[model samples]
Target: MKAIVIETVKPGGYSIINADDPLVLSVQEGARGETIMFSLDPDNPSLKDNLKKGNMNVTCRDENIIIQKGGWTSIVAKVNEIPITYNGKAPFNIQNAMAAVAATSALGLNEKQIRAGLVSFSPSIGLSPGRMNVIDLDYFKAVIDYGHNPGAIKATGELLPHLSVGRKLRMAAGTGNRRDEDIIEFGVILSRYYDHVVVTETDPRGRPIGVVANLVKQGLLKGGLSEKQISMISDVRVATDTILNMARKGDLVVLQADDVHFIIEYVMEYKNIKKRQLSKEVVNDDHSKEGGQNAG
Candidate 1:
């Protein structure tokens, strides 16, 4: 199998880096019809204007992508019949998947194999965890997500209600100071969804927990959440424990942390710290490779 690294650039964007130049393929039968919209690379300060003006030269290098407009929407593949669609834009997850499909096809995977590769894939943390499992209750629909940035939070918050109907969504959010303003803006945006909102500490390293929590609360308040709708907590363990205890069965529990492994470990440690009985499986992300298990 050829090595291909698909990087998550944003909520709905990714950059595919191929170590070796692969043969491009043409479009073929049974193509999934999904219209995509894309713009010039956001990272390039100049490309946006260049692309808008209909003139730019883009290439893939340095673990990033460079693109100009007006190119055909197809690739020459290892398989003669199938070609991967090149949309100007696609969902970050879908883009990542496409990169994999393209790489696999280049590595001699047939259409059936490429299709199977795409079908067998699922979302993981870092880009988007995709859909989180939450129950439906009389009060609200609870969801848990790993969205820490403003864009991620705003998108998730807005998208929450569309998942189910007839209920207001609650959000519990916090983040570090390096991205505090952005996180605050995200909270402000999320406050619009409030039946309720809680601003709590999330991985508050080298920063005052109280200060961070307050910042998030203030932003949400600024965003239009009633004062009574928001609360601040400095400790995530206590915060989550309290939220989980009070949240109705159907209410969502969204945990936004920068490091997924750390959150998993923290949850486990919190349980053990509280003297709860350890279940049959408990393994950190790395330890799991050694057959370690994490039982909830």
Candidate 2:
């Protein structure tokens, strides 16, 4: 599919390539246009080779996104300033932001214009829905994303440390028709970063009810997680509720799901429930104090 798409590039047109992905770079060999490459590392061999050959390149270094043309390099924007990168903790989003910069530059946008766009581009549900919407509630934080694919799961694993939380958990599930290996890979990838996993049966289309959850457990074990760290639930909504309730103050819950809108609504529901519970607790405590004073 990629090779076919690259074949459509008109001669002398512009192509933005990810210098870090070897497969993505390989398909560009047949591209009939100028290749503009982007990467997280400026010193990446492919990006370096491109720089030597005078191909336009963009990369993040020293916490800044830099664009290179032949012998010159210019800073475009600070990675921390980009909302989608999660203060430079999310390398995948940084790479994504770099891709946007490279493509916009190809469109002849100036540096000032590009910087403005970068700062304004938010990772909100209203903007890039299900991409990377971090919800900071009164207690725990939830990372909302639709990254269920293998590559995305690995990226999410990498993003764990950057969250700086004491414990990390996720609402996990597998697609119905995919191979068992693929489903297991989800558990393997997530187990590396998340301390606990709540496996849910989201679709399971035709297969048995617990098949997906079972396969994900196998992967989690293979990835070195213990059985105690895993929880298998039959319903996605119930799993979401369980995970949210399981989280304590300073704990992080990963809410990456294919149906992002539904998952987000669940988060909001949990938030409202917590708020009401807190309000009731406060009123009860005040009444108890008044009763103690009357007895005195």
Candidate 3:
């Protein structure tokens, strides 16, 4: 799939690619014309070789997203100014941004325009739904994501340490259409990153109702997580709410369900309910003080 695109666009076409990944870079072979490569490391061998040949390249240099085409170069924006990258703490998001820079650069947008677009883009329901949508409840936090594959799991795992330090809980589901080994691998990989794992509802395909969830649970246990830290909830909504309530102050809950949009909506509504509860508590405290003073 990767090589096919590169091969087809080989003639007089721009193939914006990620040079940091060797597996992906190998597809660049036999490609004719310009291939704009992007990388987090300015000194990456692929980026360097591309630049040595005067091919277009995008890289983060000196904490800035830098673009160099032959001899001319420009700095589009600083790493800290981009919110989607978690102020540059998320390596995966940063790499994604670099790819975006490569694409925009190919589109002939000047640095100024790209800078404006990058800064304004954020993860929101209206803008980017189901892609790392954060829900803050003024205490603990939760995020809704749509990534289901092992690679996506690993990338999110890479971003875990940079997230709010607290008890990390993940609410996940496995699709029956996926291979059993793939489902197990998904759980095993997540076990390395999260404190607790909630196996939620999934598409049964042809498998039994609980078969897929149990497989993930088996992987979680195999990955060294104890039975005490795992739960098999067959309903996505119930699993989400249960996990949220289980979390204490400052804890982090990551939600990955089949219906990402529904999860986001439910979590947001849950956040609003918590907000109202906090407000009522504050009002009650103020009224208690007033009544005590009046009695005195």
Runs in model 2 deviating more than 4 A are: 52-54
Clashing pairs in 3: none
State the local distance difference test value for candidate 2.
Answer: 0.86
For model 3, residues 1-296, the per-residue Cα lDDT tens digits are: 66777677746668888877888877778565688889888888888788888888889888999998778788999988987898787888888888888888787888999999889999776688888877777888888888878888888877766777898999998879998998888888889989998888667789989989998888898899999999989987789889999998888888884686688789889988988998999999999999999999
Error of 3 at 130 (Å): 1.5
List the candidates' TM-scores in order. Answer: 0.52, 0.91, 0.92
CA deviation > 4 Å runs, candidate 1: 1-92, 102-108, 123-142, 166-173, 258-296
Q: Is candidate 1 or candidate 3 better by TM-score?
A: 3
Q: How far off is model 1, as Cα RMSD?
A: 14.6
How big is the positional error of residue 119 in model 3, measured in Å on the Cα after superposition? 1.2
Worst 10 residues of 1 by lDDT: 24-33
Off by over 4 Å in 3: 30-33, 291-296
Between candidates 1 and 3, the lDDT winner = 3
Q: Residue-wise lDDT of candidate 1 within 1-296, one digit each (tens)?
A: 12121222334332333211222111211112211212223344333443454442232323233233455222212221211111212233333444565445444565566665544433333323323423333344445456666655655555555455444444355656457686567667777765666566665667865766777777887888788777666566666565544555345555554445555555445445544332323434356656545442
> What is the lDDT, from 0 to 100, of the residue 178 in candidate 2?
89
- For candidate 3, the 10 contiguous residues with the lowest summed lDDT are 2-11
Ordered from best to worst TM-score, the candidate numbers read 3, 2, 1
